[model samples]
Target: MTRRVPARDVVVFTRLFATMIGAGLPLVQSLNILGRQTEHRGFRRVIRGMVRDVESGETLSGAMGRHRRVFSELSVSMVAAGEAAGALDTILGRLADFLEQHGALARKVRAALIYPAMIFAVTVPAVAILLVFVIPTFESMFASAGVPLPAPTRLVIAASAVVQGYWWALLGAVPLPALAVRRALGTSRGRLFMDRLMLSVPILGGLLRRAAVSRFTRTLGTLVASGVSILQGLEVTARTAGNRVIHDAVMSSRAAIERGETIARPLEESGVFTPMVVRMVEVGEQTGALDEMLTRVADFYEQEVDTALEALIAMVEPAMIVVLGVVVGGMIVAMYLPIFEMITAV
Candidate 1:
């Protein structure tokens, strides 16, 4: 069965689950209520399906597990742990909070990029106008006055000619390269290479790594606290970490754990986890408070991700400003040069 959890359904379902559990309603009643209240056809169908599954005596986790597309592994594992431990309500609450926080982080990243994107959108047309419309006016005057065009003006005019004449070609050319790049990057080998490349990038790479670590630790911690075994938790965590590099490391760590090694050892050996993380995990393993320690690690790294995102935005803003200035300023200067020379020659 195709996994079919629309985004709206997940958000609504989790929140409704949290409320119903908090209200002490029976599970089946809650799901039925949600199914009736849901506006989205897809979400309504999912809820109805879950209700039917529950009516048949299937555990909520087991039912959700069947819809792997809608419910993430992390979510399912946590639900399963919650069911086993009789803490399903608490787990539902936590799941809701986690989803909200994750959504907030996504929004922050998008908001941070908006300024530069707007600048680029505004500047591209400004530059194009100067080159195609403004520069040509200057060039025409220079030609009528029999003035010798400077190399800069000549280069600008030539660029403007190409842009004006092949504007449709220019528009069509962008999608070809984009599609080719997308196709190339979509392959497994290409994705692996890209993941490595991204992790090696300076600021963005660090941010991504931290985000992955935070997610991994948080999910594992939640699962362990809810009574999932380390092996099962690791399997779920690896597949849901969202970064292929971290996912591979988690899988490797799981294999090592299954072979009778402690979880911390495999993680340390993987080199994906930092020393600080490994030391924390080791201490957590020793003290039987691994879940608490992992939660702390997740909290600490979430802050780090926030800080890194802020810094990245700060760095990118100035870089984008300089680029916009250079592109627009160069075009204007190129157009004005010939006009200045003509005035002086008169």
Candidate 2:
């Protein structure tokens, strides 16, 4: 079985391959040098296999094609175009830059979510412990004192009893929803509905839309600049779009272009591309610089994603803190109220 290479490793491999090839090293010799230097055992094996294939007279793109787990369709297509144009080193350099940019975008999105995720992880268990163990002890003290409990205190004690009685079911509740959602996403209709819903969500929806557009434009532009035809580039970009809505829009646009329609019109009709993007694409088509125009569009949207995510993080942190304070503080106050009343009577 072919090993799956990490995105970082692929970027590094592309950069090194481009440098060695630019320095006039033969393809097989370059592969040999990379293979020996690769620290990852599985990746080292993959490089050795590519070296063997190159020594057997297969093209570099052809050898890379056999390892579909490691090299994406975009990578294979770009490499093939480069080989045909005798500009393999230049294409490899572009490929490395593209991969690095994609990875950085993912990292930024992940970083924005990490703090909220950590808060939830810690908060959930702390709340659960209060419900299961701490509240019951207070319930017994109130019971022995024969004190009339407030509604809120009685409600909390009832919740504690239910949690203690059904601990196993409560545990399953956490993972079962996740499992169901995973199963749902495996279906076509579910994925389409979910992707559409994602685009309609407030705040995060705009961020996701801009990120998707940035990825779509950057990928198609890079492919076009590398000598891939418009139709083929769209086909490859759609498959890698990560969102079904964006994928469908690209496919529709590709079909329209096949019938001699301009790219902007179909995309605009699909309602996926913004007016600015549509206008830019129109200008690019008229000026014979569609690839360059798409690159500029991608750059603009990438900055939009960055700004949108920063705003989201700023808003979400305070919102989550407010929620945590209300829930936990409310519980603490509820538990202390009866004790305060008893002391006042004495």
Candidate 3:
């Protein structure tokens, strides 16, 4: 049966789960309560499934692992470790905190894009009206007045005629090119190349890299703290890391770690991670505080991502304004130039 999922209700579940565990409720009882309290049909169904699993003698981790999409590997691993150690409550609290922080980061990115998207939405319609209707009206007036038109006005009128007459051609061409690009990007080699290219982009690259680092460190740290073995934690971290480029490097490190090599060496050899990150990881290994160090790294990268996102938004606002001005203003100036020339001649 298809179940409805509600975004807001997921946050509610997290909070409720944290509260129940904190209050020392039995796991099965807590799951039953949560399942009953949820209003969303889809979430309620998932919770009910978990409750059945728990009641059937399966651990919470096993129940959650069955729904990998809903419960992240980090979350499931931490819960499993906690269950083993009789510390389910503490692990649940940490998972709630992680999800909340991640949700906040997502919100910030969405907020940053909203202004630019709004501007583009407005500007496209404005330009469309001017090209399709307003410019044509002005052209007719210039024609009926029997005034000799300048070359710029004549050019704009001719261009607008094409746009007005064959607008479907413009729209028809858009998706095919995008589809071809998407197909190309689906291949491993193409994806790898594109990811590398993405990292080389100026402002955007830095923000993306910082975000990748934050995810890597956070997932790794959480796994280590949950008592997972280093190789297994790296394997999970690599799979869970959002960026494929970073994940590939992590996979290499996992292999090396399994073979008794230090994690930092393989990562450094991959040449994707910064020297600062590498050094910190090495120090963490030396001091036997790898989990704590990874957490600090995650925290540092989170701040970096926050700053980078803010700076990107600040820069993009003015940059988009200049771009729109150049495009729209240039078109207007081009269209008016012929009229000014004719006026001067008269």
Candidate 4:
């Protein structure tokens, strides 16, 4: 009965669930109806189980805690707070809004990646096929014609030879490093190193950094606004932090808060956050509106992510086309150079 629950489905469920609660429907009745109405069979089962748990005298948060994969820690905490404050519907409504925004950011990042990935997929096998199969035919024909191959032609022939001779090695070259990286990323130290490396890369690095900031700020803001304690919110935020560097920065800020220090100080010292963010955070703290400030920062950073991603994609598309043209078109021209010379001599 285990299957992945989609974020969009969860968003819809949260919105509908809030509506039900606001209408004063019984908790069990709402859960049962939502479970039946859900299109995703797996998520439907998850909701049904929650309904059963509620019927069996377990609290809503406790049931949600059991399905941690479906319900995020932030969601559980907010739900628990809502129950305590007798405001479950209002909290659920806010949680739905937060989720929708988060999902939009994630979708934007994922969409930005698609074009580059499609280009890579097409470029690799196309180039490999030319080198391993097509180039050698031209090389053999040129050899029989007794023409001295130019440097570019010679280079292409040598590349084709290597590809044809060591195709097995070249095949292993692709998957072995991928496997090794996967193995490495499974460890904390390796993941931290990789995250640090990712944040250092050009163009895309800025997008990643901005996206990370948006995620952290939005999650923390939602939790805080939902009446979750700052420390607990930070703890949950750290777990959602896909990048280890950002995770450490957040945890450091949490420690600073525990030590009677300002949240912005440790964050600024860590150099992960910009000066503007630090100043805004400081003002938020002074004004006792940190949640609102964080939400504003998250919104701004999310916009930055969108702009950066668009600029990167615009650059990347033309760059990839030029690269493919150079590699494939260069080979075709090199093979035809001797024909041009032969035609001239005749």
TM-score per model over all chains:
0.90, 0.97, 0.92, 0.97
Q: Over the stretch 1-346, how does candidate 3's per-residue lDDT look in tens digits? A: 4344554566667678878988988877888898888777777788889999988999888998887656667778878888888877777777777777777787888999998998899789878887898889888877887777667677777878988999999879879988976887899787777777888788888888888888888878877887777887898888777667888899988888778888998788866788988999999999999999999999999999999989989999998899889868877987677677777888
Name the top lDDT candidate.
2
Sorted on lDDT, best first, the list reads: 2, 4, 1, 3
lDDT of 4 by residue, 78-132 (tens): 9998898899999999999999998987888788789889988998899898998
Could you give candidate 1's per-residue lDDT for residues 1-346 as a string of tens digits? 4445556568667987988988899999888888888777776777788888988989998998877777888888888878887888888888877787677777777898899899989998897888778877877877888878788878888998899899999989979988876786788777667777888898888888888888899888887887889989898888777766787888887888779777887787766789999999989989999999999999999999889988988999999999998888877787788778767977
Q: Residue 311 in model 2: shift from native, Å?
A: 1.3
Q: Single out the weakest 10-residue window by summed lDDT for candidate 4.
A: 265-274
Q: What is the lDDT of candidate 4?
A: 0.90
List the lowest-lDDT window of 10 residues for candidate 2.
1-10
Give Cα-based local distance difference scores for all models.
0.83, 0.91, 0.82, 0.90
lDDT agreement of model 1 with the native: 0.83
